[model samples]
Target chain A: MLEVRDLHAYYGKSHILQGVDLDVGEGEIVSLLGRNGVGRSTTLKAIIGEVPPEGSISFKGEEIAGRKSHVIARKGLGYVPENRDIFPTLTLRQNLILGQKSARAQGRWSIEDAFELFPNLRERADISAGVLSGGEQQMLTICRTMMGDPDLVMIDEPTEGLAPQIVERVGRLIEEIAARGVAILLVEQKLTIALHISARIYVMGHGRITFEGTPEDLRGNEQIRKEWLEV
Target chain B: MEVFVFSLFNGVLYGMLLFLLASGLTLIFSMMGVLNFAHASFFMLGAYFAYQISQPLGFWPALIAAPILVGVLGAAVERYALRPVHRFGHVAELLFTFGLAFVIEEVVQMIWGKVPVPYDVPPSLNVTAFAWQGLDYSVYRLFMLLISVGIFVALFFGLTRTRIGLIIRASLTHPHMVASLGHDVPKVFMWTFGVGCALAGVAGVIGGNVLGTEPGMAIQLGPIVFVVIVVGGLGSLGGALIASLLIGVLNNMAISYDFSLYPIFSLLGVEREAEGILADLVSLTTGAIAPLVPYLLLVLMLILRPRGLFGTRDV
Candidate 1:
């Protein structure tokens, strides 16, 4: 389980997250839903130690607020940044090998398991990452993230730029990952995909969590969606 | 003809020495994106260390020991100095290195005095290796060639065939991603920097005897090595080799050629002793070309092929 309690995060002097609190239980798929620039990504970044947060962060009961991002990663957290940020010049194989640095075979994900999930990656293993199509890049990014065999994976916009079909495939993949008993913190813009895959959803607006409920509660309540999530 | 052969041999020997210096520089530049101004100072330290150590131990041991000492010193600098300044940005890193170079030079002067250490060829390799086309090639020069070739081969294999090598290659293009993958990227940077400085040290050990281990050698040789890296392109090792050899051969041919030996003059019935207008032309060409060859090559390379002849990426 991961817990963020009254987090206050900033980018320079500009305060981004003001008293934000959220949680994801063991093996649960949680989605942070919001319109653009709501500090959803910043919340994920703060939890993973990419950005400094002036609040308590407890991951499985260990405080990790001001630790380095890499150190936090070694403690069984995997972060996929918003941009995919794959090494452009390196081959897919090299990028995948890098993910194995924190890999644990018994924890669920393996190199062979990833390749089975994303078959296109196996075919294009030797090719440069930049040349992959947007959808393929998304698959590779997800596969690369899984290579770390993280206890909790933070996926930031995995389906952002992909086509509708690719987005659906990624939604299914997220569901599959959750079914395998691995926790995921997904930051997603597409409400349909977010609502379809996540068990519990939190709507964020302007750096604060506006609403949190079960999937049925969120779907039935139109007021909170219009106030915070609607364009 | 004999002078041509001698100069040609000297050029190759000097070229290999330049390669050793430039390889370290280019690797550090590619990985860190900082032009280490103190690189030549490390080379100078290598010379001084070898000069001092060879007196107590033998020349062979001095060669082995000096580079290790320089590598340790380089690691210490990376840990204590470079890491602290790395957060400030690239320009600050460059300035730090420049200051480091100045400090290293002053330190060397304090420890070794402002005198050129007398570094001599080892007695075991002091004799002539061969006489070819009426010219003598010292065994020491041949020894330098052998060592340089061996190093190039080893470096090539190490960078291409090892796990750490793959990580370094990955680091060259994407340093942050390499760290994010859970590998200790700082340790990689430190080791690469240390190895780079150690290479400069090895080059200094062999070159000291040939070029003379003067206190001012680093200042004198630094620009030429920079010229080699620039002409060789920024990230390509192949470019370094071609540029080193090209500059070497050109420098040799420029100095050794006497234009009075031109067959056209003999055919035209121009007297060899008449001191014609061509004689002054030849004298000017000879006077201006030796020190300027590498610079001229650098300028031409920058203008025509900015990425260098074999570079895969832009400068």
Candidate 2:
């Protein structure tokens, strides 16, 4: 479970995330839906301690706001950034190995499990990650984060720039992650996938959550979709 | 034939030493993106530490201890001094290291005086290993060669085969992503700086006596090490090795052969009756201008291929 209250973040003098409140219960897949730049990504970053957060962020109980990124990560919070930040020079296998918190400890997910999920990674295990296609790299990033076996993962736009088929695969991967009892806070652009996968959806606008409801509640609300989510 | 063999051996010896220093410099450069100006200063410190330790303990123990000391110092510098200045950007980091180099040189002068210390090779390794065409090669030189080669092999395997090595290589490109993966990236950086300095220390331990342990030694070899990395390619270790050997052999061959450009020019049907700078240039022996070969290579490499021999990234 994760709890965030009045989270505020900034980029120099310009304010980015202002008084944003959200939550993700245990084993739940929650989607943060918003058009272009409503501070959805910054909300995830603030929670992960990448950009310094002003308000309280309690994950599974303890306060994690403004802690060092690595410390926050070790406390069972995993972050997959928007850019698909795979170690380009390193081999795919090496990238996964580097993701492990400790090489000695066996986590919920093993390298084999990841490879089984995406057989393409296993086939190109020895090749450098840079040569991987956009979709493969996206899969690698998610699998790499899963190697750490985090209790809660905040993925920022995993489907961005990916093909429709790959986007569907990524959507299934999120469901698979949740099936293993790992909580997910997804920052998604595609409405169909978000509406289908997320148990609870929070629509954001201007660094604040404007709507929170179930899929049916969101599908029924025409005004909230037009005002906040529509381009 | 004898001259060629001897020159080749000496060139390789020198090349290996250069690699020892350059490998560390390249590792630190690739990881931190700071072209540590104090790198050769760490090399200098290694020699001084070895000399100081060897005086009281012995050469063998000093060989182990000196590099460790220098490595610790390097880690501390990264944590306390460099890390704070890092936020201010690369210019601040460069200036800090540049000033640190001068400060280290002054400190060495103060402690050991303005003269070179008598850090001779250990007695066991002083004798000749073999003789070829009446030319005798010392065992110490061979020992230095072996040590450097061994370290290179170990370093190669360590980087490619180990888990921490994987983390380090990853950190070289994605420091923040690595941290978010539950890794202590700052600690990785500290250890990387320490290991790099320790490598320079190892070079100093072996190379000190041969090159002479003195205050000006760092200044003497600093530029050449930079040349090695730049010529090899900025972040590529394989490039550093190739560039080191190339420069090393080129310099040694130039020194060994006193041949002038007159013969080549005459062969090309150009007369050597020029005046002023042209006359001097035509008459100059390769041996006389041996020192400028690496710089010339650097200039040429920059002009022709800025990315370097094996580098994927541009300098």
User: lDDT by residue for model 2 over A1-231, one digit each (tens)?
Assistant: 799999999999979988998889998999999988889999988887778899999998999998989999999999999999999988899889987999896789999999999998899999999999999999999999999999999999999999999999998999999999999999998999999988999999998999999989999999999999887
Q: Stretches of candidate 1 above 4 Å error?
A: A102-107, B1-12, B258-283, B305-315
DockQ, candidate 2, vs. native dimer: 0.87
Compute the lDDT of residue B185 as modeled in candidate 1.
Answer: 76
Q: Best TM-score goes to which candidate?
A: 2
- Look at candidate 1 and give me any clashing residue pairs: none
Candidate 1, residues B11-88: lDDT per residue as tens digits?
A: 887888888888888888888888888999899999989999999897999999999999899988988999999989
Docking class of 1: acceptable
TM-score of 2: 0.97
Would you estimate the TM-scores of all the predictions?
A: 0.89, 0.97
Least accurate stretch of 10 residues (summed lDDT) in model 2 chain A? A43-52
- Superposed on all Cα atoms, the candidates' RMSDs to the truth, in angstroms, are 4.1, 1.5
Q: Candidate 2 lDDT, tens digit per residue, B123-200?
A: 999999998889999999999999999999998898899988888888888888999999999999999899999999
